[model samples]
Every structure is written in structure tokens, then in C-alpha cells.
Target: MSVFAARVCGFAEGGKRRHQLRREGRLMLNRFLSARSAAVAVAVGLAFAVTAEAKTVDPKTSSIVRGDAAALGFDPAKLDVARAALKADVASGKIAGAYLLVGRHGKVAFQEGFGVQGPGQAAPVSDETIFRIFSMTKPVVSVVAMTLVEEGKLDVDAPVSKYLPEYANLSVWQADGSSVPAAKPMLVRHLMSHTSGLIYGFITPTAPIAKAWAAGGENRNDLTAREYAKVIAKLPLKNEPGTAWNYSRSTDVLGAVVEVAGKKPLDVLVKERVTGPLGMTDTAFFQPEAKRARFAEPAKGDAGVYYDYAKPTPFLSAGGGLSSTTEDYLRFVLMLAGDGEYKGVRILKKETLARMRQDETTPEIRKAGLFFPGPGMGFGLGFSLVNDDTLQRPGNGTFSWWGIAGTEFWVDPKNDVFMVFMVQARELAMEYQRKNRTWIYDALVK
Candidate 1:
């Protein structure tokens, strides 16, 4: 089941709460909704029509509920309970600032901004805040890559060496410290599926690639894609291409490939294929001085620790190197919901969009459990695909990817639902997964 299907199942199990928003008496639905709310609701209905029957949240209801979230989806009794628990954590200094946006179809029914910006600041978070989207940028990069595919400039199944021949002689890691030569070259699909033997340079505590990645060994933000590929060319892959699934810098390499294939810089390719078409004006690698203040300060745990956006040596990591607004990111996700088109611009073909969303991993690959565990869940091109609702949290048919700095986004074709949580809390983000993410989705299931 997809996240939307899980949401529907959650709703069915949620029982009476699903009908709580039904208008009564003179409460006109229009009075409760905002234009944005209605548009999203309509989009959700249109996008996920066949996954599982989903009902759009009325526009008026969305607006009214967003203004006063206590009435949104909370079981009235649980409302106080959940709020108290959350407040208690904040009071104990367990968190700083957190923002959440939830919408069904195309409309946002719940928007909540909570906590302080830091230890001494009381200014609450707003919707316009920016976040370090980290690996979440992977999917966006994947989208950009697919756009090239739609234009017939790239092939997901083709060997990476076809475009960057240096990758043709890559070798795999041996169990001991030695290396073994690859039987085949890494393919574009392998990179997207994480089966390209590339290492995230962060995963696998004992892996040599992990150590090298930590030392910025093969991963360097200072190097251009071409330069970065040269560095990776000298390193040994952790596994044979397509033989295992390991989160790696393969997407970043893909970013470089896009540049070579399109004869443009990575950022330029991203803009031409994604941001420009989606009207994501604020999404980019370099943040102008004027917009610097809006970029949220990343936190260590509960303490909001500020860091420079421009790493002393900048490497436009296509895998994790973009800053965006909640609204701008929403537009990008909306395009995914619409299956490639947003408003009038067609970003990808519906068929291509479907292919991107389905499981790209074989049953054998999935059974190897190289990624997150799920009953029917498997890796898609760049996002995680839902295989069974029973193994999922709330949203079914839902695909998700998050940034390292407490930012997350998901698209549930089943519910026409798309959600994003933007914050500066990194180490603290995972600590409150249930209250911060799981419960938030649980609250937005309708």
C-alpha cells in the first residue's frame, strides 16, 4: 500500500474522526477554505484517483482548520493530550523550532509552526523559512535527471561510462582491505536505485568507502562534477554495480553526468529542467545575501547552531546542495503529484512519472534489505516506494525522502497528499520521529 492507502486505512481505522469536518448548519465550506487550500485539494483528488478512493478536504475547512489546528484532525480528546505532550517536551528543552505542512489533494489543511528559533529567541517559525534539504535533494536531482530522459538526452538503463568513460574501469571493495575489479560498468539506473556500488560515504560503519567519504575522500564539495568524478575514479567501489543497494554519491555523480550530457553546469541543468519550469525561484545552489536570513540555522540537537551556507570550499552537491522555501518545495512536489505537469508546464510525461515512482529494485535486491525495511516497500528511482500498508506508518502509496537538516517531503498519490516539514534541527529531528512525523501524518490522514 502507498502512503495514501495507509492514510485511507488509517482513516477507516480512525473511524468517526474522518467525518468530523462535515459542514453543519450555516457553516458554508467556502468560509473555511483559502484559495491555496482548494487548489491543493483538487490536485490531490485528480492525481491519486485510482490508488484508493480519497476525498479532498474542503477549501474552507482547510483554511479554518489551518488557522486553528486543534480542530483539524485530532480526536478532540486527544487534542489536549497531544498538545500537552508536545509542550512538555519543549518546556524541558527537548526541541527548538519545528514547522509542519499537511495537505490533501492540493490544499493545505494543517499548517503548524511551533517552538523558538533557538535557546534565547521566542520568534515562532513561519512558513517562509528555509532548510538544508540534504539527501532530500536526491529526488529533486532525480527529477532533473528524468527531465533529461524525457527529452531523450539521457537513458536510465545506460552505463554511466557511456557519458563518463572513467567510470568504465571502476573496481569493487573486497571483504578485507583489497579490491576486486568490476564485472560490469555502473549504469544510470544503478545510481538512482543505489545499486551502483557507490557509498553514501556515511552509511556502513565498517566500510572503507565510509571512511574515505568521511575524510571527504571521494566526496568533495570543492570539486566540480567532472573533478569529483575524477576523485571517485581513483577510489574503489564498495560493491559490484547492480549487485547491492547502498546509499552513495551516485546521484551527485549523476548531477555531473547531467552537466556533461547537457553541456551545462549542474545548477544550470537543474534550473532549466526543474526549478525554472516549476517556478521554484528560490530553490538554488547559491543563496543570495538578501535571502540569507531566511535560511534557518541548523541545530546540533535541541540547540539551534548556526552554520555558514557557503561551505568555505563550495561544491554544488546535486545530491544535497539546494535551499528552498516551503511554498517553492511544495510546487516541486505538486509537479510530482500531477505526474510531471504543474499548472501549464509539463515537466515529465505521465508514463515517465509512473516509471519514476514504481519500485526500481528487483525482488532479489529488495530481499537483500540494503535499504529501509518494509513489507512491500522498495527503492524507486530516487524515492522510497510503498509495497504494503501494513508495513507503513500512516500514508500508503506514499514516497518520501528527507534532508539531513530536519527537512522531509513526501508524495502520496493515493491521497493526493503531499507533506513537508522544514526545520533547522538536525540531531533533534530523528529523536522525535513519532511526535514530529508519525503523529503529524497520523493527524493529517483525512
Candidate 2:
């Protein structure tokens, strides 16, 4: 049987069987720690203890019921099947480790950790294991921008050139190698919805503008957000503003806009306005050195590399730069699922979240199939909206997105479900995402 199946079987056998599994978990943890340096082992052990003590929620008022799948309206047997499938994939060596959390009706219904920290690492994956969230950072940054909007500091419909004057003279590139002055200025909404005409340098390596971005130190660690914005504005756009939807570095530009409008650094603004209010203590641009032991390592065969999470870079990529634990991010997503409130802390107004979840893509853009990777989806302010319920598993009106490093989350407001899957392997991100979605939805009994 798979490792996950064995654990589930133990739970079925009674208290004695459950005790055996707990003992086994401790034994494995101890053996893993023995191979690591003393200092590292001690730090990891402390982190594990802290995670164990943290409550998923207040049990009395929470819908979360530990190991009671039926209480949360899930079939226990199907949940077992889902766990086995995930463990089988890990055993196949496609991914190094994974963490999953499912919340329904405002409480955690299921939570599980699988595999080791990395290919050759001894540490076992746990709730506290931090993973690089990549593009998932976009949603958080978008919400922060909305908060500025609430304060009358930023306007989504305003011309982006109003905040960053360098974009005023921007031009658009054509297939015939000619350039034309943009007919209209790009708006803040365009950036948030990925209709700003910008393109990611690495997405199309052979394009002239993409090549120019790379040659100009677009990913340089020393370049500040302001400096990067200036560099990006000078490049020719991939399309006319609002004419097409490209998964671009527009959120990073939005980050620069937020910094200018909020009159603070991007990191500081995110903490003060979003994460801090939501109680996501483990989410940040720079992973602390002390928590380095708890950070997950990527798989050996990830398709692309990531920036050093432990190193502080001036760029502060709002598009794809953030590390967070499963628990910390769950709180963030739960807030969204609850329509801007979590445990009574309101990070955003209900109306703001409603606006964020609405489809912002034009039918023309959707028909052209340029908004995002999947079918039957539309682009929202900072997320992908489910346009056709028949095509995707999540109900209509769901808002979701994922990161390149295999982290994904979705809030299904229609079904009152919020699920997060955290992993460090990018080679099979979409495949794993589909598998997890299928398994989770299949086990849903409500």
C-alpha cells in the first residue's frame, strides 16, 4: 500500500493503530534529524513543535473536525483514495514533497503532508514547511492595490502613466518589426487584469523585446522596483493596451505603482496592508535566516529556477516573489473565501472582493485564448475566473491561480470551499494541480 494508505489504514484500526502511526512519525523525524547538523536539527525540531501546537481554528465554533471526514461532508474512503494517489505520485519521483489544506464552511476539513523536504533531504515535509509561492504573490499585491483604492490613493481606471511618467512615451511592437505609438494609455485596471500589453522576458525568449528585457538586467537583484519600472516602460509593448491579455510582469509594475501611491516600499506596504491584517506571519518577500531550516527545497528536475528566498533583493517582484507556509496562506485565502473577513479582521470590503472576482476579460480576449493557460476560464482583476462550470471542476464564480513553483489555491465562494496545495516542483505543476482538484472534488459529499 502507499504511505498515505498505510496511515489511513492505521486510523481505521482504532486508537492503538493511530498511536503506532504517531510513534512511527516521531521515529522517522528523529532518524531524519540525526543526519543533519546539530544546529539545523534543533531549529527544525523547534519549528515542528510550534506547528504542532498551533490550532487550525477554534474547535468549538470551527467546522473543522480532526480525522472526521464525514463531519465535514467528505467520504472518508474517497479521501483515503485521494491520499493514496498523491503518495503514489510522490513515490514515482515526479515531485519531492507536498502540503495540502482544504477548508469548507469556514473550517479546515482536511490537511496532509507528504514526502520529504527534497530529493536527498532527511527532513520530512510538515505544515510549517515554507514554499516559494511565485505568481500567487500577484493576488496579494492586487488586494493591496485595492486597499489603496479604498483609501482614495489609487484609481484602477486611471492612466498608469499618471503614476509612472516613463510609460507616457511607450510604443507597441508589431510582427513586421515596426513600432507604433500606443493609441491609448495603459490603465491600472489593465495591469491588474494583465491587459497592459507587457510581456514576461522569459515567456518568449526569442522575441526582440523579450531579449531586450533580459539584456537590460530585468531580473537583476540590485535593481529597485522604481529602477525596474523605468527599464520596463522603455521597452516596446507586445500589444496595444487593452487589446490583448498576456501573462506579463504587469503585477510587478502594479507593485511599483503601489509603492509610489502608498508612499512606502512594496514589502512594507504588503505587510502593513494585507498580510499583517490577515495574520499571515509566515508570508514575506524574504525568508528569515532563522526559519531557513523550515523552508522547502525544490525538486531536482523543476522546469525553471527561482530566486534565492533567503536573500533580500531590491526588485521585490510582486509578480512572482513570496514564500509562505501552508497555514499562513490558508488564512489569506480564507479571508477571501469569507468575503474579506477572517476571524472578524476585515482586510478588504465585501464589495471589493466581489469586484475582484468578477470577470474582467473581454469576450474577444477570451475567444482569442490569450488570457491564461486553461480553457473555460477568464481573467479577473488578479485571478482566473471560472467562466464555464462544465469545463472546470470548481463551481462558477470561483477565483483561482497558481505559482510556477507548484503552489496553487482557489476560493470557491459558490461551494464555500477553499483549497491550497503547496509543492516545490515546477515540472508537473499543472498536472498535480488537476489531480488534486479532481481528488478533492470527488471526495466532496455535500
Candidate 3:
């Protein structure tokens, strides 16, 4: 039995206090009914019933369950220790709340929630709580583009201007406040791998191009995808396309390309090609009115501001505009872990997924140390590929990424396991993500 299962079983077996409490309550009820008042007896009985329900624990459920932790080759004790540490972190006020799910060999061994959703919010985080996944949306968008690639509707190596004419000619920004024409056109693959020389305006407010981006108001919810693209194209790029690895707004440009190729709005195309097929009903650019109660509030100390998921935005940021529940995202990761199919719903062919997972960072970029997330990882088509086991705790070949609001997920194919951690605060996101990596790997006995 898994440690969680065994713990539940042991509690049931040793619950003498529970039985004694029930017996005593029953006797008191009978005495009250016989001697004094029937109303008092009913009230006492209801109290006892509530107490009993409070002590019960529900069984864990997963879409796929091959075996328990021990049967799947894991140390239950080590896993418990990791869980305890996460709970401790919450109690210590390092974060507001967190939810974790672990699946191995197709079976879910650990799925739990801890702490309240946010300060002044009485409800605790649960499996169904929705999070602002932020940059994590890039992987899904990248996958959608790849589907077009599979259908011969799009080409990754083609210059982005082939479909989006606004990008046909662009200027490169120089440190001396001058601009030069780009030596080469930006390609689709460059956008996917974040080598398109685009930079987020919020990252460096003082840069001339960044200032221009902010001034243009490209990210306002009132702008359409094509309109956003037009504004971005007018700005000077930080580097020549495909020459340097810069964390950027390239994915947003890719979204505009997807819209042009698919002939549909990015939101509709994603629903048709990805989320709808995968049954990720809770994932979307805007949270529906009905789901407002389940949306987690961002913790007080987040470094950056976030868009209101409850309202529609003018531009669907393929880069960071997505909100999803833990359960829904788990389904998405399961599909990735299962090589692009979830319960026979094929989002991408196995070969395509393999290509997506391969590190696309050129040796030149790696040698220059321009790769985001630093030395131990390299950029893939849409995800970060683990290049060194020492830096990234997961096994090599793990594909992973996180959001600014403390949400993270990783697919470790070598270990046949995938894990996700969700929290709504950004102040300590990186710290918690790193801690989760260490704790999760420490529990892997096999």
C-alpha cells in the first residue's frame, strides 16, 4: 500500500476515541429524550453527526492509476516527508496556499492541497482551484502551432512575414540609441524557441524599444492579435533574429501567426485544437462567471501585476494569458507525458512531441550563456529542456516550465513521472519551485 493509503487505513483501525465518542453521545441523547426535552436530544445528535463527518478523509482519485507508490517503485516515507515540508512552508507564511499532484507510470500517488487561498480568504486551496498560469500558456500555443505544422498548413523555418506581412522589415535596436535594419528575417522557429529578438516591455522599462512598446500599449485588452503584432513590429528588436536567446514576447507574435494560418481567433483555435479535445474545460483566456468562486486570488507580495482573468482582454496573449485549474492542467501534462495523447485524444503525433522536447538552443547561444534559466537548462520549441541533472533535479529529458504566480509543472519521461505545484504568490515562486524539485527527487527510490 502507498503511505497515504496505509495512513488512512491505520487511522480507521485505531479510531477508538471516535467510537467511544459516538457511543457516549448516543447514550446522552437517549437520557435527554427520556428525562428532559426531545429538542435538546435532536440538537446533541446533530452535533455528534457533524463531528463524525469532520474526522473522515476521502480516497484519492486520478484519471489513470496503475499502482500505489510502493508498487510503482517509490519510497512512501520519503514522499510523505516532501509533503510535510510543503505544508510547513504554508504554516510558516512563506506562501499563501499550494496544491501538488504526482503521477508515476500513469498512476497518481500523491495529490493534495495546503493552506488558504490568500490572506483574508477563508477557503483553503483545493484540487479544483484555478490559477493564472502566465507564461506556462506558451507550451500550449506552441503545440497548437505544431499541429498546423503537422497538417502542412505552416512551416517553422519560414520567415514570420510570409503570413504576417507587418514583420517583413524590422529594425534592430542599438545601445547608442540608433537602429539598423535586421540582417535576416525572423523565422517561426525563432519565435517558438524565444530567439526572435523580441523583449517584453515590462522587463526593462528604460530600453528604447521597451519604452516604445509600453508607449504603444500593445498589451491592452482592447487590441486585437493582429493589431498587437503591428505595434510590436514597429519597434526595434534587441538583436538579430536567431542570433541570441532572449526571454521575450515572441510567443505573442507566434499567436498572431497561428491566427493567420488557422483563420480563427487565437482563443477559438486553442479551444478547438487543444483544450476542447483534451477535455480541459477549466482552461481559458478568461475565467467564466460561474468559475469566479474557484479562481485563486494572487497573494499580496507578487512582484508584478496580473490581468483580471474574470474579464475579457482585447488581445489574447498567447504568451501569458491563461487561467486553469490544477485538475485541468494535470490532464494537459498527462497528455504531454503520454507523448501527446490523453486517453486516446491525440493532440500531436509522438514524433512531433519528440521534436518539441528536443533542445533547440544552438551551441553558440549555450556558449554565450544566454539561455534563460541558466546553465543547467536549454530552450526547446516551447518548453525548457533539462540539460544537466545536477541543476534541474528531475531526470534529463524532463520538459518543464512555471508561471510568475508560483505555478510549475514538469514531465520526466526517463522516470515516467510528472508533477505539478500550484500557488498564487510570486514573491517566493522561484524559491518554492526549487525546493519542490529537491523534495520530489529525494522521494524517488527507484
Candidate 4:
């Protein structure tokens, strides 16, 4: 990839690694990240809320209803190019296995799986293969936060300390390993857009903050989300809150904020509002022991797993902790595509979804720290919006994000197109995203 393309995160590049099943029956886990930004689009259209009580979308939501190339406004010949190119990646050993589901006009035109489930797992990947959707978790949690905002349980403009005082009076971290008082308090909105200045402590093992966090037992799974936030609260920040759009543990902090603001734990809030309402049955912080076999592992030597799915751990990493199936996540996406309502279940208002897509950062802030969304994009509540197509291929008003593992999704309201591409190739997420977009764009005749 070109240097510019390599910087496409949310749209990110991948590296190689492998891991065997760890903890015996429990599977190992790892985290990966992507960043990209975009311009806003007009709301597709306001979807009227169903008057009847909301219900979980059936588990077999849209798979059986997939349309054909001609019927769905796609060029069959061009789509074959996309098909062959994706399968070629498996032949080249770039990914262990993957599946891509493409939809337009509320119907699927194409969906297919590509390789074996994992390193030693014999099952071939299918619609049900579960993935550790690292940074993609950010958008899910952000959507949940908006639900709270809609309910008046949380105020985006309020200081984060309103909910968690532990985050109060925090200092900024300087390059020289010294600290100074922050110019202003971090706001709830800053946490959602990644401008809170609270970065991942373990990103650079040798960094002073990383060392400090490790010494304070920050990585212990035994710590609850709230306790994890407390450990982060005592640390200095990378920059002033709301001043820079650094990819940090801001969402993780938002989890704690949600707990205090909603008077319930983060996982509980997500389940009650998002997963449960939308029938995203397989999406959660921990995978069940019976479902461990369905977990997709990265190619050998590509990445390491961070959590054991069989055990109930306490650290709810709202930033990168959840595992989900393509079907489960697709229901969540349809809600966004449907302007916050899936099937009959409404989780957020159309205006709130649009608000999430509007740019929330300045150009200077996006470029300030670890800016990974690449050129021609802008940061929104949790995902990147394409202002224009100068840097990437997606249409204007397209919003998207991805996991560090070879997983990505983009919804182009303008084109009535969206795709969910899932893979365990931690090192190839960016290449795959660009490839996936190109394939879909070329294949579409609409």
C-alpha cells in the first residue's frame, strides 16, 4: 500500500501474528484499531417509530432473503472480480477466514464466507463466526450513550465529572514525562469523539504512562469498568481535553460515565438498550463457553488474543472488548441504516444518529495526535464520515469504521449501500477495507 493508504485507519493497515487456543477450553483474544473520517450526509429519511412494542429482529434477519446481482442493481461480472479477489486473499494466506455481506435498498445482494475458522479450528467460517471487533466496539458504545442522551440520563455537554468525579482535576501529560493542570475539564462529548486526551496506557510498553498504568494493575481483568476508570483517572493526559482527536481510551471512560449516569453498569445498559432491543443475541463483552468453537482466530503469528471467552471477566472494555457475529452486528448496523430503529425496535432517534455522523472535531485536532482516519475525512461521535471522495473511494456522506482484526463496515446512505466484512487478519484490516470498498463500488450498477 502507498504511505497515504497505509495511514487509513478505522481504515488501518494490518500485520501478521498467530495464537493457539489458550486457557484450555477458553479462547484467547486481542485488540486491533482503525481510524478514518468523513463528511456528513443528509438523513436518508425519517423512519416513523413503530407504535406497537419493539421486538427482537429474528436471528435469521436477512440471510435467506439475499438478492441476485441483476435484481439488486449490481453488475454480475464486476461482482465476480470482488469475489475472486477476496478468495485470493485466503489463497495468499492473508487471512484464516472471513465473510462479507453487502446490502442495498434494505436487501442483501451478496454475502459469502472465505476460509477456515482459525489457526487450528477445522470449522469453515460462516455467517455465525464470532470476531473480537476491537475498535468497532467504540461505535456501539457511542450509540448506547446517545440512547442515554435521548432519555436525559446523560448530557453530552456536561463535564464528565458530573457522573464520575474520579475523572475530575486531571492533568495533561507532556512529552518530557512531566505534567501540568488541564486548561478545562473533559466533557462527555469529548469522550465520545476521542478528544478526552485519555489514551491507551499499554499502546507503547516503554512509555512512562504505560509503565505507570501497569504498575497500578490497570490490565487486571478483576477490575470492574468503574475501577478501571479510576485507575485511568489518576494518570496524566496526552493533551488538553477537546483539543485533539487522539484515539484513546475515551470510550472506555465513557463506559464508566454511562454506568454512573444511567445508574447501571455499562454492560447492563448496552444489553437493555442495544443488544436486547435489536436482538443482537451473540454480541457481548464475553463469549459463552459453548460458543468458543465459533471464535475466529487470526492467522498464526499475526496477533495475540487479549481475553478468555469462557471466563466472566470484569474489565468491560467499551473501547475494544466485545465479540460479535456478522449477523448480530448487521442488525446493529441496520438500526443505524434505519436511523436508529431496527425492525420495530428503536434505540435512537434519527436526529441523534445524524448528530453522531456530523463532524465533531477541527482539522487541527484530528491531525494533532495519532490521527489515523487519513485525509478527506472527519471524526464524528464514534465513526468516521467521508466529507468528500478526494482521499478514499466511498461516496460523500458515507460513514464507516473497522476493527484491528480484518473487519470493517461502511454505510453510504447516498448510495443505499452498506457492507459488513469480517476477518481475523489483524494485519490486513486496512488493505481489506480499501479492497472491499473498491469491489463494492465497482460492482454496483445503481
> Each candidate's TM vs. the true structure?
0.77, 0.83, 0.82, 0.84
- lDDT per residue for candidate 3 within 254-291, as digits (tens), equals 99999998889999989867777666788898887887
Which candidate do you rate higher for TM-score, 1 or 3? 3
lDDT of 4 by residue, 186-305 (tens): 999999888898776545658887676566655555677898788778888888998887777788889899888778888888887788767788888878889988888777542234
List the candidate numbers ranked by lDDT, top first: 3, 2, 4, 1
Tens-place lDDT per residue, model 1, 390-418, is 64454566787776566778787765666
lDDT of 4: 0.74
- Candidate whose lDDT is highest: 3
For all candidates in order, the CA lDDT equals 0.64, 0.76, 0.77, 0.74
Model 3 lDDT on a 0 to 1 scale = 0.77
- Off-target runs (Cα >4 Å) in candidate 1 are 1-89, 212-216, 299-307, 310-312, 367-369, 373-375, 389-392, 444-446
In candidate 3, stretches whose alpha carbon ends up further than 4 angstroms from where it belongs are: 1-66, 302-304, 367-370, 389-392
TM-score of candidate 1 to 2 decimals: 0.77
What's the residue-level lDDT of 224 in candidate 3? 81
Better of 1 and 2 by TM-score: 2
Per-residue lDDT for 127 in model 3?
Answer: 77
Q: How many clashes in candidate 2? A: 0
